[model samples]
Target: MAGTDHSVAPIARGPSIVLVEPQLGENIGMVARAMANFGLADLRLVNPRDGWPSDKARAAASRADHVIDAVRLFDTVEAAVADLTYVLATTARPRDSFKPVRGPDEAGQELRSRIEAGQAGGILFGRERFGLSNEEVGLADEIVTFPVDPAFASLNIAQAVLLMSYEWMKSGRGENSRPRFVAPEVAPASKDDLHRLFHHLEDTLDEVGYFYPPEKREVMVANLRTMLTKAGFAEPEVRTLRGVLKSIDRALGEHRS
Candidate 1:
């Protein structure tokens, strides 16, 4: 797990991720990547098939070193979540248990509320093939499910982590909440900063002949800029991006010369 940020204003913590009898090291690694993407750190594994200290998993993490380094191993799901006050068990199939079934959004909000009130909580993900057993689901405070295509409702373990982690990270962004610090080198992106970045990228793309097929240029440019804008790059992020563009442009010019 990544170390907590100890800035003047402490950061809010996301729940521990407990993987029950996960079969693949690659999947576990990708799960770590997803969790890190959404500001989650803690990871507890219950009897991983490949066992711990898996270099394959770490390599798949793609520099999510903190999460890979701090991965916790556990004997069972019951023991894994024993310290959590509220545990949400994830399942694809409906069960006979009458526990509240929450969509990711509601569960995230509730987890935030619980954490704010000093309760520790975590989410449980089951094995890739079978998913959480009935006994495992029974131990949770509630259940979480995705509204997916009924005929093909399967989700990869990493996809599940990304969705749930997104909701968890999204929950703490209310008006009253202090914004989480982005990186030590930069702050949250402003609208104007994003606008400049949009132009910078589009200009570079045009120069590089990326806007091919003259008729498709406008729509293609719009799509490209829109996707980059959604990333919400910070000040340093914008600068670094422009630097990348300059580097690429220079490289291209050298090749032409």
Candidate 2:
């Protein structure tokens, strides 16, 4: 929540995050924080242990108030997912039931497709200690299981939510799933600009006797050219290198004089 920008609107559309018997208010708050990160709102809690509107949750959320403020509480899993057309239950353990199991990425793509087709979707997260009951998982259309070490498969409620939320955002955004900021765009140095740089550098090196065994100068120059070409310098970078070479050449000339 360090980069929380209130000026930009939060994503209100995605899937509903339904927590089944989540014990801690802090966990609930963290779930809200995860939801806010990927633009998913509409948190539904089914029988939270300590009760709702917790101060601890708010503190843990790190100022993701939009998600916490709009939480919807329910008495049962059945009631919690009543309005959702498609539901995905997240569980680390494999069940005896034969519901189609999907990885996080596949589940995310499916949710994005379903949501785009005008269907409401929800992802169910079980409790901290013991996850959702077989009956609770029965309500979901598909089951999503994370790939983790079998010995330590269990994940924190917030971590699980964050993983799914990230996948959901990636599936929806396609190639656009990237950070908000990017390096400034500068024009690439043209071949002509690179050639000029090569000449200037080679001329300065000749003055400095950098290339030994005069016969190997051609190969050395070719190697230098290859190395510089691989850098793919921008126009500004090329100009800077040329200026540096000019300064060095002038300095060497003055020393010789």
Candidate 3:
């Protein structure tokens, strides 16, 4: 945890951060610094390797006094998250836990959603090198994994904290989303628009004998509708598709004639 004095800007509310068997006081301080960067204040230490109340940690923390001052220690991962309703384990590899897996972004959203619904949540950061043990991961309700290169999946403890904390903050501020390049003022796809597109497509396909044998027609038609309905084409897109279908039909008819 090389000290980054980018200034500490803690938030009012966020999930607890539990460090399980963290190896270094410096890394712990950096994790605290990262947490403070995204407004996360709750810091829980689970059996830190070098013991607690280290002046080295405080020195590394720089300006994250709020996070360091209120650090809580626990002997085990279960005890760390016992008071919380939801717990997420940050792991780079698949673990024994068959719990729901999500990316940092999705995990952040889930955490925020659960918190909003009156559920307490926390994210567990494993040891610096080997990461969370399978038994430790099993305790979490969901697993948050990063999509890093398989050849090198490990990340620093502070780096992991920064990524999740950033996502969590973005979700709360409604900024944790990709940019939408929609055409100006174009309303997104509606159910009715999609239904109309499906109907038109089915009618066109019927004329084209796409359903084949009569016995298989109902099932075939339903399947076709299912495929198109899932697309959820926007109103403009639906109109364009209908036009394309009519053009194709006209071309087929002319060819037949």
Q: Taking the tens digit of each residue's C-alpha lDDT, what string does model 1 give over 1-257?
A: 65644343323487889999999899999999898778788999999998998988998887777788889998977678766657789999988666778999999998887677566788999999999987677656688999889999999999999999999889888675556773334353443455556677778888877888878986675556445644535567778888888898899789989
Per-residue lDDT of 1-257 in model 2, one digit per residue for the tens? 26667798897699999999999999999998888889988899998999988999999887889899999999988678766667799999887565688999999998997687666788999999999987677656678999999998879999999999999999976463546886655565654566678789998898889999999986687667656755657679999999999899889889989
TM-score of each: 0.64, 0.67, 0.64
Candidate 3 per-residue C-alpha lDDT over 26-66 given as tens digits, one digit per residue, 9 for 90 to 100: 99889988888788999999888899887788888877878
Candidate 3's TM-score reads 0.64
Clashing pairs in 2: none
Q: Which model scores highest in TM-score? A: 2
The lDDT per prediction is 0.80, 0.84, 0.77
**Cα deviation in Å at residue 199, candidate 1?**
64
Candidate 1: residue 8 Cα off by (Å): 15
RMSD of 3: 16.4
Once model 1 is optimally superposed onto the true structure by TM-score, how far is the C-alpha of residue 78 displaced, in angstroms?
A: 1.0
What CA RMSD would candidate 2 show?
A: 23.9
Tell me the lDDT of candidate 2.
Answer: 0.84
